[model samples]
Target: MKIDSRAASRTLAEIGNWRAVLLHGDDAGLIRERARACVRLVGGSTDDPFRVAILDADQHARIEEEAGALSLIGGRRAVWVREVQDSALAGVMAALSLDTDTLLVLEAPGLAARAKLRTTLEGHRSVAVIGCYPEEGRALAGSLSGLFRDASVSIDRDALTWLSSVLGADRGAVRQEVEKLILYAGEGGRLGLDDVQDCIGDSATATLDDATSAAMAGDRVSADTALERALAEGLSPIALARACLSLMTRLGKVMGWMDEGKSRQEALKQLRPPVFFRKAESFGKALERWDRETLARACEAVQGFERACKQTGSPDLALSRRLIAQLCLGPRSFRG
Candidate 1:
């Protein structure tokens, strides 16, 4: 049976009852973490040779054999398979047919929705399939807060907002960065915006944000220079385009709040990833220069810019330069 993310922890606690467990999703870190938990539950430790059999994709054919074999220590065994693939479906299915008490844990990241292996596992009566995907918005914020809370560290609201905006989509990478921050702030240390900026502020993302800010504020020279610097630092054109879209979306939210009769400062403060103090002036200027209608159009154009960058044989760099220049020059310069 398929287990939703909310019920995953409960299901994992009862992992011994299942013949097989498949953890598949875009979040490789989450999949690996859950897989380790399942392995440890069945076996004493993930590395116990007597109780745990570690297998890679190439050795998937041995899954059934290993799972059916009794532990030399006379306890339930765990066959932990990493990097599972669609080709491993036969072995997995065979292993699931066994009546043994051993637990079969498979870690398959990036599996598509219609993958045969995933589908078959989900339909099995004694199998548990859990999807691990990236968390976003409030979910991500809650996760960040929980991580800090678990460490007995308090984080300022502004600092949490900034961290959420800059963190990447990969759960593993996000966890690593958060762990680093936790170390930076000693036990029971409080984290503020300055602390987060000092530890977690990525130079590439800062440059890209600088470029987007400059472009929206109509500073052509600064926008071009920042865009070139960001690209030189190995940031992709698509990343810059997406950054532009994010800024536009934030601006739209602020404008929406203003339309609701909130003051400019009030609307700006209401932003989830509140504008950095240093960039507040630029962000405010950009807001003044854009009306709601024009901002909406700019958003659509940035979306097109992103799609264009993804096309094969496209001159992404040149396209990015042109788009930034047009944004800096205002809506009059925007093409249909």
Candidate 2:
């Protein structure tokens, strides 16, 4: 039936029998995660031969026929579909509405507000929809903490935040990087920021850490080098500005705890994953130097920069360059 994801997940967890589900999310990873979670919920048999059969709209006839099939030798059976486009929703609706007794999982990209299939699932009396959005901030932190706990391992808070800042917004990508960090745990019972830094690859490294650090430190050379490298690597000024804004946001929250009677160590423990102790210090200094007003203004300016990048091409290059330069040069101060 049309159900909120929380309830659906709960139902799946307790009843353990999701006859048919339409698992929807903004990203592939979230869809897959929800799907796996659903499977786990149903107490599906793993030892029996199972199917990961994939079907597309072009093969609607095949999909419909397959959906009607009875469970094979498996104790439980599941059908998972990925990269579902809007064009396939109608057929998907038909397939899902049928009584299959099989788990028909639909993994689609974000649906349009007016989409027919979305409407169907939202209003369906027998189907469940799980929504997964691009995760960040608290959600990402929680996911990281859960990962460590599930693995019976512990991660440094600073390491988690630092790791998150480097990884792109993709939930799957972040999950992979965290897994790598866990793998890097080696023989040690506890993993720290240094191990994270050593294990994270160049692509996932928080380049902003260096650039923001350089800017905060008032090291013009380092900031300039980082910016140049970012540009060379194909990130527009808007991207850099947004990344910095996101970074500043998390840092500001950590700083807020300073006045909350929470020690840094305690705060770190409280934080999911964790922000690096060193980066936190730099962010604290930057916060004071920039102040609340300046940071807000800078974030607004960055939005404009993003618009310019999206609205034009070569002509906007100079404007973008100016924005990046201003982001770096805007008055520096240190609060010791």
Candidate 3:
């Protein structure tokens, strides 16, 4: 069974007869979070020695054998395998044939489309493959809100939007931040943007908005200041690049909608991860400065820089700072 990360919680609640699950994705944090969530749904605890058995990816034979073993605790039992790969596919397949009395949760890196492990589990009637990918936009915001909602921590819209924009690229980071926010807000406490700002400082000591908006508006001085400050505060170059990518991606869409004659308000409304109301005016300024062709080129440049940063021996921070400076030069500069 193929399940989406958004629907995993619901599916887990009604897991029915399914006993074997494969949770694999590029987002290790999300994979780990969902895998543990599944374990809890099955009435098993990861910390319980008697009810849980942790196995290595290479322990194929052991995985199958232990999964079928009766637990001494005489209640729910589960087998958790970490770092599964193609080599463990055969053993995983064999384990699925055993009883569904005990739950099996396997975690692996994202496999290729033709990978047998993904195929077999996806095809199995009693098996599930919960795909965990890096969530973005409204989905990420909604997930964050849901977590806070579960904790009964009330947060304002602006605060929620800011948190979503800054922290959701990493699931573990999001969880960690949310936990901190919950503690800061306390039970049943109402939280506003200031509370979030005080508790969860933006990466680089400056918001992505400051750097991205300044760059988009072609304010070289502000862009330089923000970029330098953010870097000094320990923000990763890859993270800065990603922030540029995100801004341009949205700006490009909004630019397209404006080209089609839609009102700026209407266009922004259509944007997922809805733009925070306070930032709308600046986003409009960005839209005015960027035409379709220029925005496309900007996106390409940012993406290229991202790839460069990932290469071995690259001076990622310096390269990213230079890119930010170039982008902040605005449309005419890029055109020239």
Q: Candidate 2: worst 10 consecutive residues by lDDT?
A: 43-52
- Which stretches of model 2 miss by more than 4 angstroms? 1-16, 36-50, 56-61, 71-76, 156-167, 186-188, 201-205, 208-245, 248-275, 280-336
Model 1 lDDT, residue 138, Cα: 70
Against the true structure, whose TM-score is highest? 3
lDDT of each: 0.83, 0.61, 0.77
lDDT of 1 by residue, 1-336 (tens): 899889987899999888889999766777887899899998989999999999987888899899789888788899999989899998887887787898999999767789999898888889999998766557778989999999999999988977777654456666877898899998899999999899856556567778888899999898888888777866667667667877888889999999999999899878876787777888988998888888888888888886787678999989988899889988666535
After superposing candidate 1 on the true structure, give the runs of residues whose Cα lies further than 4 Å from its correct spot. Answer: 13-17, 202-336
Tell me model 1's lDDT, rounded to 2 decimals. Answer: 0.83
Model 3: worst 10 consecutive residues (lDDT sum): 200-209
How many Å off is the CA of 183 in candidate 1? 1.6
Q: RMSD, each candidate, Å?
A: 4.9, 6.5, 3.8
